[model samples]
Target: MYDIYSNAREDSWRFTLGKCGKRKLLTIGLNPSTATKEKSDPTVARVQKVALNNGFDGFVMLNLYPVRATDYRTLPSKVDEEAFSENIQKIEDLIRSEKDPVIWAAWGESITYHSFFRRALTEIISRLTLLDVSWVRFGEMTASGHPRHPSRLAYSWSFSPLDMEGYAHSLRP
Candidate 1:
């Protein structure tokens, strides 16, 4: 839809991407990469494969942060309050109306990458708490209990249920 659902023309940040269907899989990564509506990076391609293979009509790519950095290690140590606020708002708009929305907690180990990342996820989960959202995980949760990222695997696996709210609360320093 619209090549891909995105908020800006620049690549520094991506609030949302992917085409929405009546039933779509919403994937949340740590941050955005170089992919756009015109092209897909490895991770986005992997997401599309997982969604379609598992019978979803479409997929929506979201992130804990919108900032685009190829290497997450390069992400700012300090959080940008405005960007964080807008990110939460955009996420609400994307998922608020869906009936029984299935969210893929694909952030994996990145949840522990920084306190800001964990904080961002908690805010998003707060909004989803009121809705009938079911969180799913693609493969295995890491040793630390975080869902695995799509880009980490080569084969698609059927999603397993994840205790999203509980998982979010467990993200302690």
Candidate 2:
């Protein structure tokens, strides 16, 4: 197991590298919740299971909320600038060491909305010059227009891989 940040809660994320060793995929999540720890993040687990089921294992997991635990509604203000920077550096280094066309998956909306995850991605994009990446927004459709349930909002969204190819291709100058 890699030495992940100490502050990160257990089961916040999990990584499974592809067995072929040719391609790499990264999955990032909004934060750790009671449900995530208990079930190993069903949404992510489903994806990882699918990858393994299909014979691919190059998957890496990251928790957007590395330092403090907070729900989606409380995320905007709970941002830790320093931790965010450190995590970004770590991710950038990881990407730099890997080959081209890295596949990245953001587990949910909060992961993308939170400054920690967003800034880290921004930094990775600017520093490492990543070629291929994907952002998957999962489980969000469940609560599209419904009144935000305080307890269920975090777990509502199902995993859906959003396109990062076109965005990465557009990045080339």
What are the models' TM-scores?
0.93, 0.54
The candidate scoring highest on TM-score is 1
User: Which stretches in model 2 have alpha-carbon errors above 4 Å?
Assistant: 1-23, 34-39, 68-70, 111-117, 130-173
lDDT of each model, Cα atoms only?
Answer: 0.82, 0.45
What ranges in model 1 sit over 4 Å off?
154-156
Q: Give one digit per residue, the lDDT tens place, for model 2 in 31-115.
A: 5443332244444455455445434455555544444344565555666666666666666665566665334344333433544
lDDT of 1 by residue, 1-173 (tens): 22456655355678888976778888888998888778889899889888888889888899998888888888899998877888889988888867778889888787787788988888888877778888899888888788998877647357899987677768755
Where does candidate 1 clash, by residue pair?
none
Model 2 RMSD in Å is 7.4
